[model samples]
Target: PNDALYFGFGKPPILVPKSNAIKRSYSLTWPEEVVGALVFLGSLLAVRGVYALVPFLMALGCAAVTTFLTLKMWRLIRARELSFYRFNLKSAGKLRKAGWAFAIFACCWIGLNAHSGWIRYHEVLGNFAFQKIQVPDELALAQVNPARWLNSTQRENILEGKKHYDAASRVALFVNSEALPKLAWFEYLLGNAEQSIQLLGQAASYQKDESKALSLYYRGAILNRLGRHEEARSSLDQALAERDDLILARQEKGESLWQLGRRDEAVAVWTDAVRRNARLALVNNELAGAARSLGKLEEASAHEKQADQFTPNDPFYQWMLGRRLQALGMSELAEKHLRQAEQLGAGDGMPNER
Candidate 1:
C-alpha cells in the first residue's frame, strides 16, 4: 500500500480531508533568456577576426560562466525534494536543459576559437620560418658600391639569397616584395641590364606608393643610361607622381630630358631639384656646366664652388671643377684639380656633367 501510494500506482488505503495543491508552470524568464542570447551572440562575434587570443579569451569566459551555471543547476537538481526548493520536477528539467544548452554552446565556441588559433599559429610559424632563412650581408653592401659588388667572388652568398627567395616564393604566406629588386640589382652588377629591368618591373608591380616609386626610379635611371630617354622619362614621371619629393627621380628625369635635347627643360628641372635638395652635388655640377655654356660665368663659378663643397672627394666633381677653372683662366688651380682627378681614376674623359 505504501509502494502504491508513493508510485501512484493505486488509490491510498486511508483518506483524509484534501487541501488545494497549487499548480505552476515553469518557463524561461526574461532575464534568463536575455543572458542566454547574449552569450550566444558573444561567442559568434569572438571568432570574427584573425587574432587568436581574442577567441581563446572569449571561450574561457564562456566556459567559466557555463560551469558556474551548470553547478547551480546540479545543486538545484539535488535539492528538488527539499521544502526550501520551490521549483518542481518540470522546473528542474528545464534547468538541466538550459545547462546542457550552455555546455554545447561553450564547446562550439571553444572549437571555433581553437580553429582560429591554429590558423594564427601557422601564420606566426611561417613568419618565423621566413626570418630564419639567412640573407647574405653582401646583398646590402652591394647597393652602396656596385664596383665592389662586381669585384666580389662571394658566389655562395648570392646563391643562398636566391635559394631563400625561391623558398619564400613557394610559401603562401611569405611576403618579401623587395626580394626581386635586390636580385635585380645583383643581376645589374653582373651586366644583365635587360634582366635587371625586367626584375625591377616585377618588383614594382608587387609594391605600392614609395616602394613602387623607388623601383621605378631605378628603372628610369637604368633606361636613361641605356639611351632609352622616352621610356626613362615616362618611368621617372610616374615615380615623381607617386612621390613628389623623390629628388633622385627628379635628377634622373633632368638627365633624360638633357639627353633628349630639351636643355632648357632639363635646366629648369635641375633648378627645382637643387632647390629641393641644395646639397645635391650632381645637380650642382650639371647646373654649373649648363651655366657655362650659356655664358653665365659668374653663375657657373658659384655652382662649381657649391659642388666642390658637397662632394670634395668625388673624381667627377674634381674633373668638373677643373674644367670650370680652366675656362675661367685659373690655370694653376685647373692643373691641380685635373691632376687630382687623374689620380682618383676619372678615366671616362667627362661624365656629360649629368
Candidate 2:
C-alpha cells in the first residue's frame, strides 16, 4: 500500500523500460547489484504471507516480471557492448524527459496521503470521544452541565464532546465510513436515537470488517435503550456473529434478553461473557443480581465479591456501576458513584446546545 508499490503497479510499462536501462549500464558495480538483489529478496519475503490463491498468483506474476527485468539488467552489464551505449543514452534521456511526470505523480501521491492522514486524525479523535461517550448517564440527560461534580472542561461546565463530533464529522464526510460508528454514538449522546440508528445503518452498508461489526453493536445498544428487545437481540446477534470478541455487544444482548423475559437465557449470555472476560465487572454484577433473584444467596455473594474485586476504578466503569444501581432503584448509592465518576472525569457527558 506504500506509494512506491502503488506507482510501480500503476505504471508497469514505464517501470519495465526504466528497470531495463540504467545510466552507464556497462559501469554497474557488484555492490549496486548486491543491494538491488537484496531489495528484491526482501520484497519476495514480504509477499510470502499472501495466502489467498489469487493474490499469491498475482504476487508470483509480479515477482516473475521483476526477475525478468533484473535478468535484463544483468544481461546489459554482462554484454559490455558499445552497441548499447547510444541506446543507454537514449533511455537516460527518456528518464529525464519523464522527470516532470514523475514530479507531478509524486506530488499527487503526497497530497493524497496528506488528506488521508487528516481523515485518519479525525477518525482517531472520534474514537477517543466515543470511548468517553459509550453510555448515557441519566443525570447527564437531565442536566445542562451534566457533571456537576467535575471541574468543568466547558465554559460554565456545558456538555463535553460536541466539538469532537463536529471536527470528526467534518473530515469523516470525505471518507466512505471510517468514523460512522463514533458519529452514531455522538448522535445517541445528543438524544437523537433515530438519527443514530440511521447513521449506523449507513455505516453498515460499507461492509468494512471492523466498522460493520461496530455499527451492528451500536445499533443493538440503541435498540436496547429504546426497549425494542427483539430488534436489539437481532442486531447484537449479527454483531457477535461478525466478532464474538465484542464484549459490549454481548452485555447489551444479555440486557435485551432479560428485558424480553428470557431470564435463563440472559443469565447464560452474561455468564458466558464473564467467562470470556473475567474483568467484565458489569456483567459479573448482573450475574450476581440474577443469582440473588434466584435465591442462591451463596452464589450471589460469590459473584458480588468477584464483581467488586474486578471492577475498574476508571470513570467509565464507575458510571456503568452507577447506572446499574440506578436501574435497581438504589438512587442514593447510584448518585454517589455517578458524582464520584464525574469528579474523576466526565462520564458520557454530552455537549449542551445552549
Candidate 3:
C-alpha cells in the first residue's frame, strides 16, 4: 500500500533553474509584459472553469506553477531584471515591498491549492470505499465503515448520525465547480432535505444529461421525504424521461406513485426495476409488501426471500430500508430492519463500527 507513486503522479515535479547558468539581464518589453499578463489571467480563468471536473489535479498543477513562477519572479527581482523604468530610493523601496507582498500572496495561494488538493484526495478515497463494496470484509459482513477508510483530517461531522460524507462535501465546495449535485446528496444524507433541494436547484444550470437526471432524481427523493408526492412524481418522471436506466429514480418514482394512491402503477414501476436489477434488495422488500397487501402470499414470500438474499449488513442501508418500509405501512418488517440498524450503530453516533 505504498502511496509514494500516487503522490508522485498527483503532484507536479519541482523545477530548479540551473545555478551554473550565466546570469543575463533580460529586459521585459511593454508588449511582452502585456501579453504575459493576458496569458496568466487567461490561464487562471480556464483553470477556474475546468477545476470542478478535475479538481485535485488542477489544484496541484496550479500550486506547482505558482511556486515555480514565484521563484522565477524572486530571481528576477534579485537580478534587477524588472527595473526597466524604475529609479530613485523611494521607488526602489516601494518595488521591493510590492515584491514581498506578491511573494507572500503567491505562497498563500500555493499553500491553499495544495491543501485543497490533499483534502480532495481523501474525498475520492472515501467515495471509492463507499462505492466499491468488493472487499472481502465488506462482502462477508455486508457492511462498510466509511470512516475507517476516510480517516480524514476533517473528522468532525456537522451532524452526529451522518458519517464521513460531510468532509467530502465541505472540500467539494472549495475545489469543485460541479459540486452542487454531490453537495445535494451529502446534505440529503445529513437529513437536510430542504437544503438538498436548494442545492439541486442551483445545480440545474451547471449539469447536463446524466448529471441533470441525477439532480432531478435527488430532488424527487427529497420531495418524497417531505410528503410532496405530486412534485416528487413530476421530478422523478422528468428524471426517468431523461435516463430510464436510473434504477434509483424508478424506485423513488414508485414511492411517489404509491404515496399518491397509485398503488398499481407503483407496483408496476417496482416490478420493472426489479426485472432490470434483481439485486436491489430494498425494491424487493417493497414488492414483497405490495404482494402481501394484494393477498398474493406465495409471490410475497418469493420477494421476501430475494430481499433477504440481497440486503446488506450496511447500517445506513438498513436504516433507509426501515424508513422506506415504514412509509409503505409494513410496520413489522420496518421495525425489524430499524432494530437491526440500531444494533449495527446506525444512529448510535459510532460510524466506524463494523
Candidate 4:
C-alpha cells in the first residue's frame, strides 16, 4: 500500500524561480518547482528500476537544476557591474544569497533522492513521506559502503543483532539481492561481464520469499545481459504475468527481443514500460534509443525534449539536450548542450557505457 502511492522515483526536485526575471503577470514556462515535479515524474517512469540503474536520472536532475540556477544567479550578480546594468553593492545580495538557498535546496533535494540508495533498508518505502506508515526502529539501518566493507567487528555487531530476524516471511527477502549485483556491476564497469553474470546468479540463490514472477524477472535481466535473448523473454513473460508493473523485466525483455531482431516487438515492450512508468524519463530515453535505431531522428528528438523539461541546467542535461537538437538537425543548439555536458562531470556515478 505504501509502495503504491509513493511508487515513483524519489521526489522530483523543487524549483523556485529567481525574482530577477519577473515580478508580474507574464509567464513563459511553468514555475521551476512545477517543472521540477514533472521532471521527477518523467525520470521515474522506470519507477523502482531507477534504484538498480546507479541513480542516473536523479543525479541528472540535480545537475540540471543546480547548473541553471547557479548560472542565473551568477549573471544576476554580474549584472550590477554594468553601467546601466549597474554594480551598486547596495544590492541586497539576494543574488549571492541564492547560493544559500540552493545549498539548502540541493542538500534536501539530493538527500531525498539519494536516501533510498543510501538507506534502502532503513525506511520502508514511504516511511518518510506518509506519517501513518509504521516502520520498525530496526529498519532505520544504513548501507555499508562497499568501498569500506565493514571490519569484522562492525559486521559482527550488525549481524549479531539482526541476523535472527524472521526474514523467511518477508516480502522483500530479495531486497539484499541487490548488493551482489551492484558489486558485479562495478566489476562489469571494469570489463568483467562474465564475472558480473556469475555474481548475479549467486545473488539469485539467496532470495528467500521471492514470487515466481520476480524470480523470473531478475533471471531474465541476467540472461538478457548475458545475450541469452530467448531464455530472457520466457522469464520476462512469466514475470509480467504476475506483475504487469515490472518495468525492468519488460525492459530486459525488449532488449532481448531487439537483439533477436524482433524490432517491432522490442518497441512494443518498451512502449508498455513507458506507459506504466510515465514519470521515468529513462523510459522515454529508451524510447528515444529505439527511435534512433529505427532511423527516426525527429521522433527521437521529441522524446528527448520531454526529458529536458525536467533537468534544464546540468551539463549532462545540456549534453543530452544537445543530442536531441542534433537529432532535429539543430547544429548550434546541439553544440551548446554537448559542450556543457562535456564541461560537467559525466563520469560521476556513471557506469561505463560499454
Candidate 5:
C-alpha cells in the first residue's frame, strides 16, 4: 500500500478511527443538544423559577445547525473530499462544495448532539422498560472486528494454543476489551444488529470473571446499539459492580446514564471517576465528553487539558488534546496535535471509514 494514497489507514469496515481521541470527543459531545434539553427541563423544575431554557434553547438551535452541517460534511468525507487539507487553495470552489468549513463548524459546535441523541434515545427506552435488549436477528454485523481489518494493530488477544479450536476458545476466553465496543459495530458493517447480539450473547456466556466484564460490557454496548438502554445499563452495571472500579465499565455506565437522559447522574459518575483517578485518558475523555455535552466547551477543553497533564507523553492524551483543539477551531493547533497523534500510534480501533 502506497503511504500517500493509502494514508496508512487500515482495512475496510473495521472503522478504527485514525485516532481514537476523536471518538472520545464524538462520544461525549454529541449529547449536548438533547442532554442539554433534558438538563434545561430538569433544572427548570428545580429551585426558584429561574429557568435555564435559554441554555437549552440555545443548545438546541446550535444542535440543529450543527446537525445539518454534519450530515452535509459526512457526504463530503464519504466522497473522499475535504479539500482544506490540500497544500494550496487552487480548488477553493470545489473544496467549499465539500463543506469543509461546515465540517469545522460542526466539529467546533461540540454539542455532541449525535451521540447525545443515541444516549438519550436508548437510555429512556431501555431504562423505562427495564428489560434486556433484543439482539438484532442478523449476525454478520455483530461479528465485525473493526480493528482487525487494520493490519497494524494487534488483536486484544492473540490466539495461540494446541489446536485451532483451542486457540479460538482461549482467545475468546481472554479476548481484548479494546477489540470492539459493540456487536453492532459488526452489525453495522454486516448490515444486521440482531444476529450480532445473539452471537455476542452466546460468546459472552462462554467467558468468565474479569473476562466476563468485557463480554458483559460489550454485550451491554450491543444492547445500547440495539437501542435497548435499560438492558444495556443492566449489563453495564453488572460489569462495573463486578469490577468495582473498572475504568471502562465506569465510563460505559456513565455513558448508559447519559443515554438515558440522566445527564446529571452521568456528570456525577464522571466527576467521581475523574476525582478518584485523574490519570486515566478514558476517564478524562468521558468527563470532557460530559462537559462538552453541557455546552461547556471550555470545561471540556479543560478536562482534556487535565487528561494530558497526568500523562504528558501518552499518545492517547496527545490525541485528545489534538481533537479538542480541532473541535475548538484552532486548526493550526489541531493539525499539530493530530500529526503528533498519528506519530504516537494510539489504538483508535476503527477501520478505514473511507
Candidate 6:
C-alpha cells in the first residue's frame, strides 16, 4: 500500500549521526581536586583572624566546606567504576543525604562556636569580678600565705588586675600607690624580676612614708638575688631608715654587705638583727656563718645552736649547720646534722665532707 507504516505518535524522532553528535562527561581532574583543597585551606587561613569577631560566619564557611567534602567522599564510596571523580546530586536520595549532612554539620559547628563564646564571656566576667575585690583583702590573703599567691586562680586574678591597672593608667598619669607594690609582687611571682623592680621603684617614688618601706625592702631583696650587692645595700639602707624595726631588712642588708666584701659590717648588721628577733632562724644562721668567718668560734657556736633550735624541723637549716660544723672540725656533730638533713630529704645527694 502506498501509505507508509506510521506509529501511534504524530511523528518519529529524528536520529542524528553518531559521529556528528556531542558527548559531555562530568569529572573532577587531579588539578581541580588539588585546587579545591587549596581553596578550602586558604579560606580557613583567611578567616582565622576574624573568627573571634564573626564566629557564626566562620562556622558557616567551615560547614559549607565540610558538606562539600562529605558529598565528594559519598560519591567516591558509591561509585561503581574505578577512578570516579564526578559528584552526582541529581538523585533525590543523594540530595536529601547531602542536605541532612550539611544541616548536622552546621548545627554542630554553631553549637561549638556558642560554647567557645560562652567560655570567653565567663573569663571576662571572672576578670571583672576579681577586679572588684578589695586590694587590702587580696593583699592580706597573699601575705597570710605567700604560697597561695602562686596558685592558678590567684595568678589569673593577678594577671587580670594587671590588665585593669593598665587600662586605668591610660586614663591617668599616675599609678595607685598601694597597687604598685602589689603589681610588683605579681611580676616577681611571675618571674619577671626586672619588671618587678621597675614597679617597686614607681611605688617608692609615689610614696616616701613607712608605707614605702615594704617596697624598698622587696627591691633590696630582689637586687640581692640578682647579685647587685651595692644597689641592694643602698635600697635596704633606705628601707631601714623608713622603718628601723624591720628585722628582715637588716638581715637582707647584712647579706648584701657580705656580698660586697664588708664582712665586719655584715657581721655587725646580722648580730643586731639576731638581737632584734632572736627566734629568726635566718638571722641566726647568717650571724653564725659571719662569726665563724671572723674566727669567733664561741659566738659562731652559740648562734648555730640558736638557729638549730629555732628551725629544728627545717632540712635546709640542718644541712647548713652540718656544713658549718664540718668546717669547724666537729666531726661527730657534723655527722649528726648531716644524717638528719639526709633523713629529711634536704640535700641533692649525700653531703660531701668539706
Q: Say which candidate scores most in lDDT.
A: 3
Determine which window of 10 residues in candidate 5 has minimal summed lDDT: 153-162
lDDT of 3 at 49: 32
Q: What lDDT score goes with residue 23 in model 6?
A: 73
lDDT of 4 by residue, 97-153 (tens): 444554456556544444433344332232222222222111111111121223455
**Model 6: per-residue lDDT, tens digit, 146-252?**
33325567677677766654554444333456656766765665567788889998889877768788899988878776778799899999999999999878987
Alpha carbon lDDT at 99, candidate 6: 45
lDDT of 3 by residue, 198-250 (tens): 88867865667888888888788778778888998998898888798999899
Candidate 3, residue 99: CA error in Å? Answer: 22
TM-score of each: 0.51, 0.51, 0.56, 0.37, 0.39, 0.50
**TM-score winner:** 3
Error of 5 at 341 (Å): 2.9
Report every candidate's CA lDDT: 0.62, 0.61, 0.65, 0.51, 0.50, 0.63
Q: Which of 5 and 6 is the better model by lDDT?
A: 6
lDDT value for model 2: 0.61
Candidate 3 lands at a TM-score of: 0.56
Model 5, position 258, has a per-residue lDDT of 72
Candidate 3, residue 261: lDDT: 90
Model 2, position 274, has a per-residue lDDT of 88
